[model samples]
Target: MMMVGKPVYGIAKSRSAFAQAMKSQAPQQTLDDLFAAVARQVPEFGGMFLGDNEETLQVYLSVVSPTKVVAVQKAIVAVFGTSVIPKGGVKALQGQYGFLQLKDWYDRMTGPILRVSGVTFTDIAEGRNHLAIGIGKPEVESRVIEQLQKLAIPRESVVIEVSGPIETLTHTVRMPNSMSPWPYLRAGGYILTRLLCNQTGVGISQATLGFNIIGPSLGAGFVTASHATAAWWKLDTIAGFPPADFYQASGYYPPHLVGRETVDPHGFTGGACPTGLICRYSDSAFVRYNSNVKFGVGHIARTTGITTSVTSPILTIDHGGSPSGEFLIVAAPSVPYLTGLTLNKVGHYTGWTQGKIQMTNANFSQIPSAYIQVGCPGGLADPTMPPAGATLLSQYVVGDPTNDVVHSGDSGSPVFRSLKGLALRRAELYGIVWARFAGTYKQFIFSPIGGVPFQPTGVKTDLPPFRYCDASASPPC
Candidate 1:
């Protein structure tokens, strides 16, 4: 979890005032220390969040015993001092189970629950202090409940909702003309690859380039969705198959060779995964760009004219290499994973959009055969039984009821939150858009940058020059 200052609730009349208020609050370390003290003192501590009023620190407890509540209150007082404990006092609420317990139950019950037909996703709802299971069909709710009962999981500790199917957001055809012909490549720009699937013939695939990164040994590269590459299913199967080449703007044309896939770990069973479940931390792939291509670190393409058709133009509003039109990534701080925190994303197809985080640490189910056929065709044989599917862990789910937050060709888009007080046109990097729920325009999912496997030592930015120090080098260069 990221360190945060005092919670800001409701609408802020002035960004400067909001920043000043955050600056005046007690250091984030104090809250962290208080949380640690409470966790050590109260074993039933469920979780913590900012109260609706913004001043109170709302703590949840499984049992909510008088002694535990008093201990938590005392800890808060000791940390913040009785006289200056914000405006609203700390409050302890009754919860069904502790956060850790709910996480454990989530790991244990995901396979069984997903085995039931029509199940879509599962999440550890830290804010609500319960486990949530999503199903596509309402009739399967009883079966899901029965599965939970069989595992001895309390019904009250879990919530089942109809969420429909989850599908990847990679588009098979060329996207609208939002491509940037700028001298440098940047985040939120377009990337393309050609695929010749055995099942589906030749086609061009498009997805958003996530961000620019650099490592001590890997040099400079960018990240994107693994499934958007050509012959992705053969990554782990075929030997000596050529690495897929990526293009920008135009396909099979000059000045289009940008990079090639380098690091993409295939899914596997066992080793930290629950029994019978295939596991992977991210649906991301790292691409090492060519030396000739200039990469603009922290720069996100400013786009406009959003449309759902292939013929319509989605124009890149910024031109002539001006920084004013782009969103500058000031920091890549860890997210607090709090529900209702507003986040924004810039995709090649969707342009820029905003939504609130609905769930954190969400796990989405993928049928084993379908997953392998699409991204790992020549791997292990298909399983004949249920509960033997793939589960993607540690994902953020965002939704906006009034608008479509994501769409086809938006995979690998940069997901972030604006930092209004820090600077104009500045934001913090959070995650990368990967998939969206089918039949719904509101819900989409992203993989947190911190959890992305093989991520760079640090995210590169334009303002501050990023330096990579190798611990193994002589004199720790």
Candidate 2:
């Protein structure tokens, strides 16, 4: 079944019922309106998520009063009707702080908390209705708690756990079969850029193409990880490497031109990024295709016989398979909360893999020395290093306990959810994969597609508008 909306609770009896519930609006829009209504009715709305059984919507509030509980119940019934509500109705729980307040604390404390040695990531756990911090060293937990206490942040409002360092997912291998020879470009296809690696000693760097995007006035282009271009900064000392050129198969002699690097903001000094931190809304970059190049709008490549080993030399990409093998991108939703939603991605190295979202609105940072050691070149005193801090904001953390959900060379891979019940091989585009945590193959991170910075504010997926038609509608409808 295809579950839609944030905290998508309960199950639809049929496809038509689901469509009617959503009406003409996208699932996300409908849910957003409902949540907004609840927030308006209840001033102390903390957050919401699905119950453990996935049957009831669990709403949390700073103060769980009878009047507020009734308001939340009314909001749910008004938006989704009584049938959608569970037998127990909408359950309200008492929380230590409101969601907005926690978010404010999250934003204010991310830099300071990350500055603590061994801290790996920080996020707001909506289900728990509090802030969650992950540290690489268990011994550092007390120090982190002390920092929070110094800020007057309630000890009961936060949870700390031991974790591993998060690292970029750029692969360096000599896989001749990873290249795409097809005339039309598609998402998940292999893309290589040798400009940055020539001096770093990391040979033949490769990444997966995300998806096709177009601006009303900017024509067409494709998106990938900005780091994949190896041009993170404007002052690249490497001669003839200012703007990295991307190739379809290989950058060797008779290179197949895919596109030219266009929009990639190195780092912003202030705003959502904090003054001293090298921060980016998304770890993505735009690549404008050549004039004569042809591309698929929302098509994503499918492969079979994927290798299980993370260090494997090659992935068995099946390009000549039937149309059923391809996944059609039907919709793009800004998933607000992703605690337990199942999502999947296809990459050049890992092929097709699926995992559940563990956290959202998460922040992760890498020290300048660690980043530089892994192919990037910027010393602590260099312009690339942020004097204050370096962190990524609003990232999705996904994991699969038993397997490696993502690997090197998987950066820029399209992350999406399967909507097979609605239409065969149909899916919704969610975000793009960028990095994974070290010492564990179980987790990786992605940035939402809507976060990609493009000019004119009209840039979006090239796919046609998605709509649901009645059974009696006209053939074209």
Candidate 3:
């Protein structure tokens, strides 16, 4: 929960920082001097807030110096979403504070043109002006009028507009003292980026946009990796560019778990969503993550049978594999209530990462397609939706078995069904990933749709079978 570049502080600590900022040089220092003093309080990342002090008072006045007006305006805008009236800032002049009439308040907020909000220019002359301000996160119009009312000038000169309960607040509420709240800060969310990446089948997230060029047609998708977890930028650069990159987007859905909560006594976990099935209904695109993608050339290490058990929780890729990593998935079986199973969702590199398993059992009948989708997290190869107990090999045209074993960027990855190895069926060598290639290896890569070229020669690194199947999650043989 740590903010990338912000200090952790309680209200009291923050107040201390502000007070410390006030102790510098002289009370009547220049605006630049004021900013510098407040900056010292931050001590790190330029402590982006400020407080009221004699120097702050002086600097506040100096803001009228024209050079500092815009600076003040910018800061004020950040906190309340707009600047104060021309009559002056908090230091300019103070006489009265109250609820001004709505029409006058509205006028001040909207201006004669009735356009921009949360900004004002008040030059009160006489009488009492009662203006009631709105509550938190007020409308732009209300924000501006609220500042003017805080001046507390006489009632005759001002009136105000309140959107809801008409809470009677003093014109001048405590401003950020510094710009803690600004419009620019709440611009993006991590989950959205992650979803966009996965849904589009691309390999990049939205958090990394600053580092990557997000032109149109680049699409929105990303591939995941345990290798380059935190240091993903290197991979990003290597993949060229992934549009709309975002970072450290973390989220999880417990309802999606299997056997534990939603499952029945017989071992059937009711229907659930597949982790990696991108629908054509979505306007998604593809992406590339360089090192982030491990050319998962490995296998499962343990033995498994289709059975329901609570004595022990299933170990995911954590099961014993080999001296090197290989593909060994937890095969699932068809049951009335349970449609899917879960895995450890982590990497345990043990075997040779790139060896073939000539399926000694070779039986995929009782396996449910639901489990297969889970194996590929957010991916499902239903192609034309076959009936129950149908083996996937029956669904596709097999190409080269030797070449099908591994490919580039497929490292530390698992090709599975039911979120495990048993359901995983390596694509026929040179088979299509269902994605098309717009460009060629010889030329620049075009995005959106492109062909998945066959595993080129030489790029292949020979290794033994690393797969280890969990005897626990596999179907009853």
Better candidate number, 1 or 3, judged by TM-score: 1
- Please list the C-alpha lDDT of all candidates, in the order they appear: 0.58, 0.59, 0.20
Give lDDT tens digits, candidate 3, residues 1-477.
000000010111222332222211111121222223332332111111111211221112211345434454444333222211222332321223211222234334322212223211111111121222212123554544445466443334443332222110000001112323221111000111232222245332211110111122222123222112211212222223222232222222222111100100011111110112111100111233333322221122221221122122222222233322223323221100000111111111111112111111000111111211111233322111222221111001111122222122112222222222334321111011111011111100000010111011222111111112233322211
| Ranking according to TM-score, highest score first | 2, 1, 3
Cα RMSDs, all models: 8.8, 7.0, 29.0
Candidate 1 local lDDT, 1-477, one digit each (tens): 111111121112233332232222221221222334545666687666554523666678878777888877765444334532336776787877765576567768977886677787776665677778888778989999889989998899887877766777764113323444544543455555444332234445667887766655556777777666543322422433345667665344435667777666555565444566666556676777888887666766665434333344354555433354566665543234445567788777667777777776666775422332333344422111122466665567877656777777788888877766533466666677888877666767887654453221232211112211112212110
In the range 70-153, model 2's lDDT, one tens digit per residue, is 876775555445555555557788876665677667767777887887787777777677778888767889999989988888
Error of 1 at 158 (Å): 1.3
TM-score quality measure for candidate 3? 0.17
TM-score of 2: 0.74
Q: Which stretches of candidate 2 lie over 4 Å from their true place?
A: 1-40, 43-45, 51-56, 61-70, 76-101, 172-184, 189-193, 197-202, 233-240, 250-255, 305-324, 334-336, 366-369, 372-388, 454-477
Q: What is the alpha-carbon lDDT of model 1 when measured against the actual structure?
A: 0.58
lDDT leader:
2
Clash counts per candidate, in order, are 2, 1, 107
Q: State the displacement of the C-alpha of residue 169, model 3, in Å, after optimal TM-score superposition.
A: 51
